[model samples]
Target chain A: MVMMNKEDFKTILKKDKKIIDRAFEEKFKDDNPLNEALRYATDSGKRIRPILFLESYKMLTKKSYLNDEIIEMALNIEMIHAYSLVHDDLPSMDNDDLRRGKPTVHKKFGEDIAILIGDSLLNLAFENSLNLAKNGQRFLDASLYLSKASGIDGMIKGQVYDLRRNLEIDLSYILEVYKNKTSRLFMAACVMAGLLNGLSEDKLKALENYAYYLGLSFQIQDDLLDKNEKNELNILSCKSLDEANSLLLDFNNKAKENINKFKNNDFHIYLIDYLTERTK
Target chain B: MVMMNKEDFKTILKKDKKIIDRAFEEKFKDDNPLNEALRYATDSGKRIRPILFLESYKMLTKKSYLNDEIIEMALNIEMIHAYSLVHDDLPSMDNDDLRRGKPTVHKKFGEDIAILIGDSLLNLAFENSLNLAKNGQRFLDASLYLSKASGIDGMIKGQVYDLRRNLEIDLSYILEVYKNKTSRLFMAACVMAGLLNGLSEDKLKALENYAYYLGLSFQIQDDLLDKNEKNELNILSCKSLDEANSLLLDFNNKAKENINKFKNNDFHIYLIDYLTERTK
Candidate 1:
């Protein structure tokens, strides 16, 4: 196994991001208003979700696995992420005009087109995943995991809790929000990789825990960096900056510990530190 | 074999609608804001898509099929339809306050919740469909067809064209919109049934054509009944009322002819007439 130097990890991440960007560009090159909005919505994110999926697959398969199907699955996760961001930035939602320092979908296109684009991206994710799923049961299982992680009981419920978080300020309630909203898709990323690689149940559970901790830590780090001032639910709302930082570290430590079960998990360990420590 | 009389056809339609409504109620019995919005949005719609799917399946298989899996598939299609309506009724879209004589999802709940509920319903559809897809290839194929038919190149594209219909008023453009927005899902309904029943490719094509014509005629009839006054695209805009009526008749007749190859297609033939002649 390659040593997990921070520089090497960054290089791998940059390379993976390029791969995902190229795949996304290829997927939505058609000329239409819908395609234009889709391209705009999916453009130029950090693509952490797909990279997380790719890294998890590498860790589990113990190979530099960059197959087309794997890339397609990663792209599907990214599409779901893009759709969420688009909807979250709608006029009745967060009402933001910018995403990733660029005009948000609703801002660039009209609100109507924004809504259609979000729906289109989500539908495209399923269309592509189902196409891959026709190959075998493993792909279908991976897709099913992705679906559940992003559905009513997962990400959508998190949005509902977030909208009503003012009514309840308890730590357990906040953590539940973070768990469902932020951590569910991340959990799906790792767990989908585990399912695709045919990992044992114990290893899969370990990956799930790893992803859970990693996702929570990542969200906390995001709040720490953004210093979000909105009324939306955030980890920094109740906890002081120092306490939130420590909580991030604790989750990161837990994430690193969970991946210790895998022999080739240097990238996993390095990723925990990389994500939680990143600025901006 | 039972002869398809008009009264018998109406009875079958009502029965099928009830079966679909019951399945929908069972699917969303979970108590939550998201589930509540889902139930409200799906409360009533005549259950046309699922009924079309069920009728197609019956026509092809020549069996009075009421299996749980088939009902689940039908529910999945209805969920997609319900999600579309919820999103379409948003303030930025159609801005409709009433749907099927009730307060729309956005009117009853907040727009943010409505958006989340739409996303949840769409996610739940794929989630359920993927679960069934694990059983075999037929289910997977059907789900894939549903996905493609409702995605960017299909229904979403139709919505996009609709939003920009003022930019172009050509007959071909409107027909394209009708084909993608309206016919695509209906095509998926019948073709999915064909796939599930393992019909031959030729027979599948016939079903696809039948659904296409039926869906177009249904939309024309909808425009006739609703007398849409919005600036949105409608066939009545380009053609006289009498011309639109004759066009509807032509489509219905074509739909009937396409399904003539099936020995048990009396119900399908009667459906074309019932849908086209309905006043409301």
Candidate 2:
């Protein structure tokens, strides 16, 4: 809880999560192990990534949600994010046995099925989006941005560094991890939504900046949550508690300022604050 | 090598393989583990799939190779095919130690890099194409077909069946595996090329049928080449050697007949015959 209408925010978040969940279930209705594994991995979550996309699109379009095309784009964003978690928790990757207070995908489904599940979800995102005949250039552009954001220059790069490199090098090194591993996809979600809405070039860049600062804070907060005591490689471990608190506030404020420049900042501003301020 | 004009067939196949190889090499130029693994997995192959696309495109447009856009599509096709191979050889999957007489990606690069390599390549394919601004609806339509052909109803489903289900059930089961596992991507390659050239509905169907029969033969012959001695679930062990040869000839003639319906199939007919007849 924060110094705000806590219950009101919770209600809004729950409603938004359901909407995205229904679309995901609809997108994948086939009765099979892969779908079973896919739906399982995607069943529970904050729906923050998809919500960010929806909120940005809403702000730009002045609509509560989106048309069919953009809605599908939002679904695909969540799907990719879920797949990353599935893969991240794999035995060869993070080797984690639990996530979201439950057995990881590998623990329940086996490593092989878990891997294929993640893979199928990734492909499913593309298949559903590319299969749509009406998205046009916006669709192409969004899909491209989504791929790059998750590929070598984006999420995967962050993951590679985390997995293969020494995380205890310095603060700058840790920041790179947060930026690539975390910020890139966040940036993609907001930026892609703006692209889908045909925002001006300046607005797109602004949206990206907004996601960047918010995402960095989001990653650091995650480190704080997961490792309260902190490791030498983590943001909290490198900085004192007071410093970390001020840093989070700085980023949260910067994110708010970035969106403030946009003409329609209602949903964007609300979502950014929600992402940075919410307690899990 | 098989009977008639072996040298001539070898020269042509080599030439076609070189064309696709150059495109793949050119598409991936970055210096990183991911890029290195991507290039390594794609370093050597017969290039039969991309050749099928090029031949079909040439047959439809009377263009020997392709323009920039179509070439990117072709490269993307090969990239997906290569990614499939890398994943298929994973420790949790087929666990293949060698491919094309060289160490597999997992064996050479370790499992983590190998897994990410496959994933990054998949994303790279879409990034290169969907990122292009000028591809239009034809590009979208072709991408849709590509996803379906390699996704649930296509290669992945076949792979799931292969992994979880018993392939030794019956010849019918084996055929389904061949159709989905091996043939769909081949069908996609040719049909997508035709789609790029804006071929008519009739011609597209014709191209699909031609590739289907040819691809079926190609898979059977591959099983025969790799396991002619009998591997229980393979083509040779499932049937008599005479039956296998008869099956190959039957599919070869049918593929030829399908293309015979097309007016300008000079390259198409030659390529299909080459794919079915060649031995290397």
Question: Top model by DockQ, which number?
Answer: 1
Colliding residue pairs in candidate 2:
none
Error of 1 at B101 (Å): 0.4
Q: Residue by residue across B63-133, what tens digits does model 1's lDDT show?
A: 88579999999999998988998998899888999988989988999899999988988898889889989
Residue-wise C-alpha lDDT for candidate 1, range A1-280, written one tens digit per residue: 6587879888989999999999988977877667667777887888888999999898777788588999999999999989999998998889999888988888888899888888888888888888999778889999999999998888888888888665658667888888988899999999999999888999899999999999898888888887856776676778999999888888888888889988888888888888888887
CA RMSD of all predictions: 1.4, 3.4
The total of clashing pairs for model 2 equals 0
DockQ, all candidates in order: 0.82, 0.56
- lDDT for B144 (candidate 1): 90
TM-score of each: 0.97, 0.92
Location of the lowest summed lDDT over 10 successive residues in candidate 1 chain B: B163-172
Clashing pairs in 1: none
lDDT of 1 at B99: 89
**For each candidate, what is the lDDT?**
0.87, 0.78
The numbered model that scores best in TM-score is 1
User: What TM-score does candidate 1 reach?
Assistant: 0.97
